[model samples]
Target: MSSDALWYFARGSGVVSLILLTVVVALGIGARSGRPAFGLPRFAVNLVHRNAALLSVVFLGAHVTTLLFDEYANLRAVDLVVPFIGNYSPFWQGLGTVALDLLLAIVVTSLLRHRIGVRAWRTVHWAGYLSWPIALAHGLGAGSDADTWWLWTISLACLAVVVAAVVWRTSAAFEARTDRAVRRVEPRLRAGIR
Candidate 1:
């Protein structure tokens, strides 16, 4: 209803967007692990990941829209498309724009995945790994409450969750590969080919 409310909304939505992005990334890693997450099936994990990603986009839209409307930030339309051009916190704001660009690319490619082929879709999707960190950096650097302890706590939690997921995924992949290799080699050894 007022500028103050708009500012608060922007900040709140930005935080929520970051949280949602973290969930999406974690769920993606879980999906790759070939194991169920939270006792849920792989398909369920995938569904949650897709839904969380969409929700992040929604909150991001709110964050950007409110920032543009809030006169204090002095955000320009160009700032949304082109990174680093904004006079207000240029570097930090630019990182947010870059993150947004990467996210949009991933979303667009995902939507057109059937047409783009699996390789192209997967290559673009990998940007999710990069997007989350850029977003976290933007929040820490550009956010007005960056210095707050609560924000730090939340950021750390997000970081921990993602790190754990990645570690789990990597180990699972290695084990699967090792199992396949063992299977192949064992058959050859039994046949006296090794």
Candidate 2:
């Protein structure tokens, strides 16, 4: 395939990943907001959120690796991690570097959560929110196929996940109803226990 075609194809992948990343962030927000204080049964929510974040990371890995191989991009694996390591676009490279910093912050915080303290770790972990926008900007700025229909579709889908998550968390009725459901279940019966 031609480099242009491959570049667009990679951007297509980027679009899908953007949605996945958005979902991870949204779920992370929900999982964070519904702490023990809300008495909203956060165990499952947190679990899903954590898994979502991991999946997002996986998607990001795929996106970066694929981009590196796109002949149109003079990107190395180090460029993905080191930000401005790309010789092609110095300004966009800087943006990538910032995004890389955020990704690293999130990964390091998650891995060291115990030592960092929950509050501090969570605060740092919230940087996942910044990763999407930075990535979106990089895709648009550096991607050769930013205008492709698939790319737009993916971007919109990612936007939808963020919107849905915000709506769900802010819904008073949903929270109250879910809380009642949890109460009905009984504590010992919570985790598939008899």
Candidate 3:
């Protein structure tokens, strides 16, 4: 394909990847509550989270592959793994590289969760929360369409949803803790303890 086609494909894939990543993040937070989301069962929410994550990976690969092939991008293979090494906009590209590395670690640990154990897997999975914002910043700083109204709309919307989901998750966790404390206190009060 032509350089222009490759560049366009890379841009499109990158945007799609970002959107899918957003979905994965929001669904992941929702899944943690062990409650239904978007009228779907808990299992369905988890299923969508897993599938969205896989799709984001596929699109991310496409974005990188297309950029590597596009003559205009001037992206070297090493730049894919190493942060801040690209010829064009190194800092912005480096953010993407860092996010990619984190994602790779998460995916690897997830595949080996059974062997590595849940505690280790959970630790690695937490990196997903970190990667999302880094990836978002990378897109804003590195993308040629960064200033476009459509890109801004999509990015802002994604940010809004993720932030909302995080707030909900934290509140739910706090409520659970409060309930446990109340339960403990109730029993003590019933026994006439001070």
Candidate 4:
């Protein structure tokens, strides 16, 4: 493929990956509430979340592979895995590397959740939250299209989705706690206990 094609492919895949990752993160947060999403059952929501995550990984791989092959990038194999070793924009590139490593860990643990036990898997899964922001920052700092209006719009939209999901999750948790407390207190008050 021509260098131009490779570069365009890399950028396209990266953007798609970011959008898919945002969906995965938002669905994950919403799933925690044990509520259906967009009229889908809880199981369906989970299925969509899992599939979106897988798709995001596929796009991420394509993005990385195309970058490696793109003559303009001039990236070495080691640069993909090692943080801050790239010729251009080392810090931003390093963030991408870190996000990649964290995502790999999350994927591995998820695949091995049964063998590793829930606690261990859950611990690693928490890294997903951290990885999303790092990946976003990397895109903003290192991406050629970062300065473009459309790219900023897409990025900001992704950020808004995640933030809204987080807020929903927290409010759901708080409501659950309040309900439980009310349940406990009502019985105690009815029984004449302070």
Per-residue lDDT tens digits for candidate 2, residues 1-194, read 67777676666666666666776777676665455423436787677666766776676666666677778677776776666657778667657667767987888887999998999987887777888778767766766566778666766777777777678777997689668867877775967776
Q: Put down candidate 3 lDDT per residue, 1-194, tens digits, no spaces.
A: 98889999999999999999999999988777565665678888998899999999999999999998988889999998999999999999999999999999999999999999999999999999899999999999999999999999999999999988888777866568557768988989999997
Q: What's the TM for model 1?
A: 0.87
- Scored against the true structure, residue 91 in model 1 reaches a CA lDDT of 98
Number of clashes in model 2?
1
lDDT of 1 by residue, 47-153 (tens): 89999999999999999999999998899999998999998999999999999999999989999999999999999999998999999999999999999999999
- Over 51-71, each residue of candidate 4 has an lDDT whose tens digit, in order, gives 999999999999999999998
Which ranges of candidate 4 are over 4 A from the true structure? 172-194
lDDT measured at residue 68 in model 2 versus the true structure, 0 to 100: 79
Reference-based lDDT, residue 44, model 2: 70
- Evaluate residue 114 in candidate 4 and report its C-alpha lDDT on the 0 to 100 scale: 99
Ranking by lDDT: 1, 3, 4, 2
Q: Tell me the lDDT of model 3 at 181.
A: 63
Location of the lowest summed lDDT over 10 successive residues in candidate 4? 31-40
Q: What TM-score quantifies how close candidate 2 is to the native fold? A: 0.71
RMSD of each: 4.7, 5.3, 5.0, 4.9
Give, for candidate 1, the lowest lDDT window spanning 10 residues: 30-39
Candidate 3 runs further than 4 Å off: 172-194
